[model samples]
Target: MSTIDIIGLDGYENAYPRELSGGMRQRVGFARALAVEPEILCMDEPFSALDVLTAENLRSELLRLWQAGDVPTTAVLIVTHGIEEAVSLADRVVILGGDPGHVRTTLPINLPHPRNRKSALFQQITDLVYTILSEKDYEVSPDDIAVLNQGMYATFQPAPASDSFQQAASLSQRKPKSSRSEPFEAFETARPTNLDISEEWAPNQDSPLRYPQLPAVRIGSVTGLLSFIAEDDVDLYVLGQRLQLDVDDLYPLIEAANILGLIELNEGDARISAKGQRFVGASIDERKHMIRIAALSAPEARLVAQIYRLLSQAAKQELPEDLIFDTILLKHFSPLKARKQLDIAIEWGRYAELFGYEAPTGTLFLDRGDEPAE
Candidate 1:
């Protein structure tokens, strides 16, 4: 009767786990926990999977038990990503920070019991928690991200440029050019005409030979983010906080936008640029043109262009995807990383309409529909 009163699972006690809905199963689990009569109950993401109404009801019932001193547990500790949920339930919220993750801060929620979500005090505390979580000291340096076209999986780093001629001579002697064929030769020779080989290889540049991990987000997401920012001037950290985006989810989008000159980040504030504004206003076709123009600066774009040129020159407009996968990407990256990089390249290329990929046929080709910009 006590369990049924708390969880409200009256007639469905006999229902198996497989037969019950997710919420019903969750309620059953809670009832089981209460049945254990433990002194302390610790829940990790307790309501994360439930429907909004069900989660709210469960929270209310738990609070009822905690306030009335009905449960065996004198204390309840919940680990949750939801800021609002924490503010609603916890008397004190302790946040963990850093790479290894340590105690950052413990915040006390002073709001009265049965907190009203719409109240200004609740909002204020929620915002405070967000500010604390998104502390500016944790910001990622743009330079810390690696450069593209560099070999991430290389066994040895190249020595100083003074040793380059000697290294090349030794390499030439050690391995004859005749032994390398097809894909390897093609990939090596596919360097863009406009690419500055000397500049890329210059030893003066810091970490020039490191591979860049591309943004995990798609072009639509990039555009959507820009449009979202264009509506208002926002601090990057605060914006991320409101959206519940962590460093990993938010930083890459910022980096990608920064690289394309679409958004400017100044002291953690993100504002859409003139180019970004134009992009937001443009039609689908014109936006593709913009993506092409901005993306030209990337090494991946140049490499794709080079490949397209080679294939066109050979009167072979289409090439098997496996050829490039094995020769170029796999040489520098692990199979997983290579696939990720290839997907990035594909996204960029398709946005620019520089190339088309047919997954069914496992082929890549220059898209004839994408004519030169006027």
Candidate 2:
């Protein structure tokens, strides 16, 4: 008599045979077979009596145990009637033909775990196997033959939208390098001649411009103001220098925020609006999501910043200066468009007073504190 427990059933030793369900009785038979610590375990339609879900569960449990290396180094072989179940559970599938059950074909499945039935490769293999089975010289009804023929082409194809990543990458790579270069010239020409400290900094109350939607500038400005308010008005020039943006780019964002009742901008200094303060209080993920949504909605420097944020997040770090060109290419934007977008973000930063250039190292920093007007 077998002494080993099946499916962790050692505690049920005294249970009456009549009390167990068919599945439990099947498990008992399995336990008895395992008792002698056989070097090999063969399951011959052991799951046939169980429901589909129970059979699948048992198959998974068996595979897990086999992988755990706890059971005495035993090789397992399972026989099943369902083709999908056979494919799922077997390392190799063997089909029998002829009246005496002679082996007709053997197929090796080398797919990795967590296989997707909907993949092209899975369908291909299933079709190939069905074709092999259909070639046997047995008489079959026309309906059965038609069903087998359809199984040969059963496959899933994803919608066109699923190809965005590839399309985006291809589009970015094809853009000319010269298109990206002209924007920097525009930025260089746009820098302020005299730092106008006395200009009445009324909040630009206009609805954000639609086309040439430049949201990054606004976001940078708001970020700068938030940093400034959080750190105490430090130095204006230092803040500008830190954010690597021109004053022009910085001003509009702050102005936009003021329009939206999100911040207060005054004489080269900015403080958060009540809404802005609440925005800052949101979780980091929420803030990023909001920034992305807002950037998508309007023409502001924030859009450019959102793109940079996406690239940075995807790359898992700040992009190197030299690689920025290549990164733009990967985004599917023409080099010109990418350069325009990036320059827009940088310029907007400068305008919003969120960024400034370091004369010594030339590195941009997120200058939160206020700087005295240069």
Candidate 3:
């Protein structure tokens, strides 16, 4: 009964699963998870199925209870894709990435209780996490986050560039040439020592490469983000509020823009790059040309360029969209994850005019190029 009251399902205790709304069902899940009084509570995308308001409400309730010492667990471990949620809830945020899923870096969240997402310090802290996760800096000490709580948000020390991944170029079974009508710059990368073949996309192996990991976000939203900033510096927290985006919804958009070289992040502010200003001003055709050049330059999956290169190697210069999944994305991600990643890649490629697709048949092929503008 106490658990029922805690989850707001007190009167629905006797109700069957089918009799309750989806949010109610989620509340019941919370009740069950809490009933046992486990030492460490684990939640995997707990609110993913709930509507936005319900998720917010539930998160609020849980936060309230945790602060009040009503939560039974000694620790709460959440595996989430929401960047802000992690920062909001944890004392320490552990980010995991790469093919085999290693800890990219862990940072301390030193904010006071009942955190304010709108606080300037909060925004800067979130940006630091984004920086670590985006740039894939493994050697970065956890102490890096210490600067934020000390009121020093201006500068960041990028640890020395570590060894490059050996899997990117050397693992390619053959050096396939781009066969498009207007050929693209080759996927120029250093050959590391290995002959491994796997479906997971490799990060860029450029000798001096230092990119934030590609946030799992789509090209459309990223374009929208660029349009939102429009050549001005905007506070990221206010940016989130103006867009009515939760901390998580806006992370990908920010990371994508930063990684694509369209924006620069500093002290919780996002400043549009000169390239971004041009992207905002360019004609539709010109935008595609620019994105084509930028995205291909992305080391993460060579997002657009690599796909175009692969299609060229195909006998028909095209293949079922799912084929890329089997050959490149699947070995590292589950089918659903692979599909989501490929879908975004397809969206960006199609938007960049790097490739074309037939949705009904899931076919992906090269799109004719208008040479990218300088």
Candidate 4:
């Protein structure tokens, strides 16, 4: 009772989870977790789905409880994409880099509690963390920059698009690395421009059945993003600034474009690829074909494409929705991400004319009634 009350669900004890709002349900989750009063609490991107104010309120309450010694947990471990959130909460910030992800560096945040986000020191720390996350873990040699200057990144593009593929990663699996890092002057000197950073960022093989997530974007937005890159290259940080979004938020869009060979990421810049050049000019039908081929081709987005294919082939191009949720999406994505991936697949696949679903029948088929016109 104390746990539930502390977590802000004072009168909702008898309420079913379905009756609660998303944020309320999240609070309920915290209440349940705290009921046992475990020694350590581990949270993975816990606030990612919440609205900004709700997430802020929740974090504030959690901090209040911890500061006042109201909770029994000795330590809270949180994995998040929000840098400011990390800095505001974590005492030690561990930066993860490279595919198969490893800690590249650990920087201690020695700031006093109840940190000020607008302060000069806070901005400085955030900048340092940004540079750390952006940099390749390995030292860059001048010789490497010299080679990359000769247009080596062009080769980073995937094999020519195919009409069909059994595995997306097999056909679309490309090794992507481009060079450049703006060094944080606080701890490092200026970095060389035009580097071959292939070793830094590459697709994971997911050897032991690891699942890749679909970008939290729709197909329509991707077209606009591609068009922006096609017009002229743009730095990722610059884009983030313009959009008032975190740098991490932009990576998914970049990855989606990279998976489809619609754009190439170099250093912090996103430049259009040859396929992207064609995509901008392609007709509606041709565009869908391009996307379909790319989906069945790349390692990153390939799994989602494959899942869509499985759903399509099941029951001769028609299957129950339960089959999609229980057998397909859930198998690949975590429970939290499975429904999102389904929504993503539905919206994205429709743009590619990929597949369709019937709600009442709980069937997967090739119907495009709601597909947007070009």
Candidate 5:
């Protein structure tokens, strides 16, 4: 109880929840839980409501108590929506799938205690978790996925074999010092042309009309990610693992890039498309213009246009974000899907300068300052 630092708080022992600050109240809750001396401690986003410093302090204190065995609890399970928090705290992270939840993967945290954020090893582990979470339900052959060691390089094989071994050190020796840190060099020899993915799950490569459900990625990020893929012919899973973005964070970028004809997804592998190359090489104005044109062609953009027209015809130039959220989006999609689509819509409008969002008011309107592409 004293170790959590609530003991020194003035008159905290007698203070009710209403009397204490949010952080103090949280600490009291922690102390109360610890007082019982239970064998296992399970916390559901304990420090979520606290400020940054308070959360940090609590995380550190909790780790100390867990490591020192100062309390009766031997094991602690934390449920957090924050990926970085999970990576920072857990020895093994069990990723759960949606709906009827089931374990997707259990990743072991091998980084040392009090992990350094700047270290390559720590980044590798973080990226690995992101890769796991970003995975899609599409059927992927084990061979199509590039398996790296300790978040470094390895040959991507379509099938398992003993002879297909390459050392990162040896690969690094052959490269110039400047390129040594580049991850995909080891897989250069194993790079295959468009590994076969099932047609059902693969995006409509032939049709320009159909678009995948894209993540709400900004134009800048979309271009940067496309450029990286152009330079490195990496697998989607491998790329996400390297970038350290889970499905929630990664897939949207992939979908957006793909939709904009900025990248190509063949099997599980992602490569930059010709248009993406041009966009990457173009100036910011050129890139924005291209994205604006691309956005005009997308289904989401059409919906935004429709809403804008409807509002304008009704003698209103603006509409509440929630109005669109509840009426059109939620009507057509599930609550969760609707929320994601709304996010994507807002991002699209802003990036193309097609619409403006007043976040304070949660309203969307025509972006008069954002001139249309001439």
Candidate 6:
């Protein structure tokens, strides 16, 4: 019976008995016991020597082997002091009470596999188990009660602002000096020698440029930027709701990018300018380079470039419709982080060019060199 492949212990059979730890010896003993392929496998505190994490792993492995039909046992009987271990591994849990250890009650755990810890049923069971354990004769002092009360009070206090402070500090460090000031001053000071024809054609305004800091990234911003470019018109309120953002969080970045000549906003419509178009058209590596450049000259444009890169990377094979927006949020940023970045992107990132496709009513038409823009 001890010579079988139970728990795959055959490979370690050559080791001297003295060399094995208590846990290893117990495992070997279990394997040897199962070698007989008995009708029933009985374990008396089998995992008593193993740590909690290791015991859980071993238990899972044993369950897997049982499910695989290798074990001939009709049933498994295990004795353990741990209620959680019993609840996790056993089909029926028998609770013993009294100093001599007599059966108090038998509990049938009807919960399905991969039981949810957050479920109400699990919580109820946990509370019952805790109550049963606490019922055993134990002394409680005023000091203990005071300590417990202190712990409860601590929970209600707001958590320290270290994380938020660190984030703000890091963002401040990453922010170029110009992002906080008038971007046009820097742009005029270092005007490019080879200005594009479109830049020369656009009218210049003397409006006081207001640069609002972006809150964070958003999914709606990506969709809105795409729509604004493609449709040439979008409702501010509708776009705000789509991106799960407020108008206050969305407008600043958009306006800033417009001021920096990265995007154009006219007739209640937002569109990417020629400079913005070139940046998006560039390769991923090149886009990042342009982003740094835009950030120095215009932080809003830099943000827009980053959003476009995220969208491009996310939409690998197919256009990432609103359905996959959450996925992108999770992949690139945390739920909290996503909200922040998206808010920033929408507010600052330049819009892209969007093109629509329509089929003729009766006849099919094909055009060359007119690929639809994503």
* lDDT (tens digit, per residue) of candidate 2 on 1-374: 22333243332343456534454466677677776678989888877886433343345445544554545646887777666666555667787887887987667665443334545555665666676677885444555345444434544332121111111112122332222242222222232223221122212337453323333332323432453342234344565665555677555555555543455556766555444443443322223333433332333333344433333343343334335445333344566676555555544333333333232332333322321123
- Tens digits of per-residue lDDT for model 6, 157-265: 2111111111111221233233335343333334232334223222234534432334443212221243223224455666556555577766754664454454677
lDDT of 3 by residue, 192-223 (tens): 11212223345445545532234676454565
Q: C-alpha displacement of 167 in model 2, angstroms?
A: 36
Worst 10 residues of 6 by lDDT: 159-168
CA-lDDT, candidates in order? 0.58, 0.45, 0.59, 0.57, 0.54, 0.44
| Clash count per candidate | 0, 47, 6, 4, 4, 20
TM-score of each: 0.44, 0.35, 0.43, 0.42, 0.40, 0.34
Query: Model 5 over residues 291-327: C-alpha lDDT tens digits?
Result: 6556655443445444444344434567788877665
> RMSD, each candidate, Å?
24.2, 25.7, 21.2, 21.7, 19.2, 24.1
Q: Between the candidate structures 1 and 2, which one is better when assessed by lDDT?
A: 1
Weakest ten-residue segment in model 2 by summed lDDT: 159-168
User: Per-residue alpha-carbon lDDT of model 4 for 83-180, expressed as tens digits?
Assistant: 98887777778877767877777766665544555555657667667766777764434553343233322222322221000001221222223222
lDDT per residue, candidate 1, 1-374, as tens digits? 57644454443433345535565577678888988787888898988986443464356556655665657788899999999889768878888886888887776666554455555565666776777778745432333122111113222332221110111112222332232332222322232334443245323335646545567555545654663363245788876775567888888778877766678787878887656655544433445666665555554344444445544544567788787676466656799987877767666666566666766676777656543433
In model 2, the runs with Cα more than 4 Å from the true position are 1-6, 137-374
Candidate 6 Cα misplacement greater than 4 A, ranges: 1-4, 99-101, 136-374
Q: How far is 12's C-alpha from truth in model 1 (Å)?
A: 49
Off by over 4 Å in 3: 1-218, 230-232, 369-374
Q: Which sections of candidate 5 miss by over 4 Å? A: 1-213, 246-248, 300-302, 308-316, 335-337
Candidate 6 structure lDDT: 0.44
